[model samples]
Target: MMIPLAPATIAAPFARYSHGVEVPAGWRLAVCSGQLGMASDGTVPESPREQADCCFANIAAILAEAQMTLTDIVRINAYVTDRAHMQGYMDSRDAHVGTPPPASTLMIVSGFTRPEFKVEIEVIAAAP
Candidate 1:
């Protein structure tokens, strides 16, 4: 199982995330690579919200395939090409993951491997 942590001495997280996460030893884990806004057929969406939706969907699909779910995720790393897209990222993410969310980091990047790519998300999850 994973436990999200945010101590009183630390600043509260800016969004739907925790400051740290704890996963006990011996639990099965999955570390996902950066997932872009590509559909299963390799099509990239133009809108940031659409892309964010696709990104989380892809992440969820990966976890599902491994017999896990979003609730099991411990850490999340999000990268976006522009600051303007952050709202969409946060909104989409909050829609997918539940309360006391995983420890997370969000970055604004200059660009991506593909110019059309607006966001990339990476995740680490532990089995219960």
Candidate 2:
């Protein structure tokens, strides 16, 4: 099984995420490309929360193809267009991730390929 690490010496994580994750030997790993907040139908939602949800949904579909689920995720890297979108993204992330949530990083970026895109997410998952 994967291990979640949060050393006592270090400050606790700011949110629902582990400081780091230790993937065991002989496990299969899948790394997904950053997914934008666009739907399969090419629709982009105006709300940041809705867009974040779409990003997670896309990630889920990708993980499913590798016979893995979000629970197997070990790390997550997310980007938002502005600080205002942080909470929305965090809310969706908290809802989607499994227990002992994966190590995570969130950043505020200038923009994305499309102006309407508010969030982008990528993940690394490992399973035995």
Candidate 3:
């Protein structure tokens, strides 16, 4: 399980977010490369939300390939071209993760491998 690390004083106020913490022991760790919004047939979606969905879907598929789920993710690195769409992506992510969300870093980049593509996501998972 992902444990939030923080002193009692610091963590009380920021209970919504986990304190800097450590990954549990004996868990299988997997580092996934940045997944673009390309479909299985190499089609990139035009909408940012669509792309973000596709990217996360691709990530989920990859994690499943290794017998993992989103709950096993400890960290997520998200790259998006538009800031307006970031919240949507986060919402989608929350929908996927449900509870005990992973630590995530969201970035706004200038462009991507495909101009139509709007988001890419990379993840690190620790399986218990």
Best by TM-score: 2
Question: Clash pairs of candidate 2?
Answer: none
1-128, model 3: which lDDT tens digit per residue? 78756576653522222434468778888899998878888887777677777877888888998899877778888898888878767766776662466767788999886687778889888877
**lDDT (tens digit, per residue) of candidate 1 on 1-128:** 56777799978888789899888888999898899998998899898878988988898999998898888888899999999999998988888876668889999999899899999999998885
Residue 105 error, candidate 1, Å:
0.2
What is the TM-score of each predicted model, taking all chains together? 0.93, 0.98, 0.84
Residue 23 in model 3: lDDT? 85
The per-candidate count of clashes, in order, stands at 0, 0, 0
Q: Rank the candidates by TM-score, best first.
A: 2, 1, 3
lDDT of prediction 3: 0.75
Model 1 stretches with alpha carbons more than 4 Å out: none
- Which stretches of model 3 miss by more than 4 angstroms? 6-21
Model 2: number of clashes?
0
RMSD per model, one decimal: 1.2, 0.6, 2.7
Error of 3 at 122 (Å): 0.3
Each model's lDDT comes to 0.88, 0.94, 0.75
lDDT by residue for model 2 over 1-128, one digit each (tens)? 67999899999999999999999989999999999999999999998899999999999999999999988889999999999999999999999999889999999999999899999999999998
